[model samples]
Target: MKKFLVLGVLFILPIVAYLFFASGVNNFAKLPVLTPAISDVTNFKSLSEENVSLEGKITVLSIYGDNVEGREGNAFNLNEKIYDKNYNFKDFQLVVIAQDGQQEQVKSLLNELSSTIDIKKWKFVFGSKEEIIKFYKSLDTNLKLDKHLSTSHAFIIDKNKSLRGRQENNNEEVRYGYDTSSVADLTNAMVDDVKVILAEYRLALKKYNKKEGLK
Candidate 1:
């Protein structure tokens, strides 16, 4: 009886330990860095007279055309999906950029959007189409205002101003999802990337601030 009990304990212990350690490793695996730091743009302003920057917050940016049908509505859908899941993170911001002269329309769209989510975290900005395209280029995206700007897409910019797309830093397949697979897939994948950034940032802070007694 004693010999049989020992064999059972040994088999159970190794299986339990392997599962525990495997789970931890999976959680700590590194996700892609996405992109280099985003470049700055000038001549754009957020709603309510606030200046905009990519510093110190995670920014999700989408470019919209005022005259394009359903542009603002498409952006609103993506915003609602992300906000509904991750609204607890105060540093997460959604920035919608429109072509110049569309401020009133953008404002109206925002007014409607405010009824559903925290519109305070949503910023509507516009500049000349030329400058807006220039701003898009600064982020290293493939968008061209003349042809390829799609309101259905959103770019995740990290707190350090880096665009989070396709910068694979690990063997793990945890890269940003840039495909238009479906609205549900797109929103959920983007939110997962956001959580990855937050997790990495917190881990970095803990490791680097240990000696400083930082929180």
Candidate 2:
């Protein structure tokens, strides 16, 4: 009777552990989509004159405003904390939208960053002030761009052109964007959220491939 009891305990332990981890994965499968199908950036012209698009890409979108030169610190903070860690992911990109005339300043900043990091996936796009404002408004978030047409906040835009972020829960305020200037915010919140979105896509892809395999 004691041998049978021990065998039953051993058999149940593995099942319990599997169920626990599976529940955790399911809970984090999708990051909350705060705004659905926001504007795409295909209309803007990249610094290289290449066409840039937010569709079918996981974009870290930012507005450098008219004061591109003044936001150098913010750029470096994001580069070190966020871009460097995730740039290797195939569909991941960092897109900065700056006023049309700030091309030189944006180029200079990218040149400096290129010395130590791969800037290939980091794209800077140009647009008129009115166009930039129009695009920013499309996000439909409470966050505002300053008079200089800039904000320290950077947003995550998924492949479907939707704004993804944390919802208000446990008395916490809704977070539409991460503060680029705050390393703690990027490290603790932004990085983890990025991982969740990436994992979500990977799981979807696996399911798609499996379905095709059966066919």
Candidate 3:
């Protein structure tokens, strides 16, 4: 009887420990929302003249400013590291905000990217300089756009139009955006965070469906 009891304890202990750690991992998988209810981009028109909205979508947002040509390297880096991996997610999008007159330059860039990539989920929206500044301000982040109205950094915006990123990184700094120029930042940090946010939504959806089924 004593031998049987010891065997049962040993078998059950491992299972319990596994379950406990698995729960912790799932809880940690959720990405934190830094800013809530960010402004939508529906007021602006895409390169195709269609209105774009941040609602109901997981967006990687960037401002390319007026020099779409100058930032060609940044665009390519983002395409390779980020969009190429997650573009197939139905609600995922890459929206670049550019000044209104840069449509031709944007078209040229798109033409080059399209030759080698699907480019369908990638969108470029145009707005007046004033409108662009106003929209950027609505994000309420600590970062600033450069003099050219561009930044090499890209941000994650969730389905609720909230800004998402690490509140404190390894350097003990608040990280609101990923540097598009750095492959390491995209590969090491942005990729994982994007997965987390997508998983967070997937779990919520699963719960919702299960509740509906129970009803």
Candidate 4:
């Protein structure tokens, strides 16, 4: 009886340990990660033109929702106002995320932006109302949504495809908390951030190039 009991204990211990480790591994595998392929989307072009992948290029995602301005079209655009030599982040991609109710307003804003700015550098996309809500929940971002996206309280995504920063066009110096007046400044900030990131990517890429050459 003693010998039989020892064998049972040994068998149960191994099985228990294996099951414990397997459970941990399964949990780790379920963790979510943002990848380039999932992050990649069709570029927003007003006409048939060249669309390039700005993977390594820094990008900003302009989201639109109920929190927009004047019920106008909400657009995600590249910040092109900065012109400092040190600030050379060039490849900027802007994805517009908006709800359906604001679709017309978003399109209108895009049209207006095109006329006033060379939005050729932007990639705007409008999301369903449900999708807009999901994005915030999934990202766990802290953005005060005013139910309209045409305003300055928009989110910005970084090149690594991770959301990096956000700023509302809340400059008392600028009239209208959210309007065309803030577009230039908002977009400019996006551009400036891209340049800073691009510079770093380029530097890392350079090191990689040299290392690969040696190999």
Candidate 2: where is the Cα deviation over 4 Å? 1-23
As a whole number from 0 to 100, the lDDT of residue 142 in candidate 1 is: 51
What is the per-residue lDDT of model 3 for residues 3-103, given as tens digits with 9 covering 90 to 100?
Answer: 99999999999999988865754787777788999899998889887768899999999998887888899999999888998999889999999998999
What would the TM-scores of all predictions be? Answer: 0.73, 0.89, 0.87, 0.51
lDDT of 2 by residue, 1-215 (tens): 99999999999999999888766766755799999999888888899988889999999998998988988888899899889989998999999999989999998999999998999999999888999999999999989999999999999999999999999999679999999888899999998998888878877888899999999
RMSD of each: 5.3, 3.1, 3.8, 17.6
Model 4, residue 45: distance off in Å is 13
Alpha-carbon runs more than 4 Å astray in model 1? 1-29, 143-150, 167-181, 208-210
Can you give the lDDT of residue 15 in candidate 3? 99
**Residue 18, model 4, lDDT:** 86
Point out the higher-scoring one by TM-score: 1 or 4: 1
Scored against the true structure, residue 68 in model 1 reaches a CA lDDT of 30
Task: Score residue 205 of candidate 2 by CA lDDT.
Answer: 88
Q: How accurate is candidate 3 locally (lDDT)?
A: 0.89
Tens digit per residue, CA lDDT, model 1, 31-86:
55556776653368666778877788877777775553457556656666675666
Query: lDDT for each of the candidates?
Result: 0.66, 0.91, 0.89, 0.47
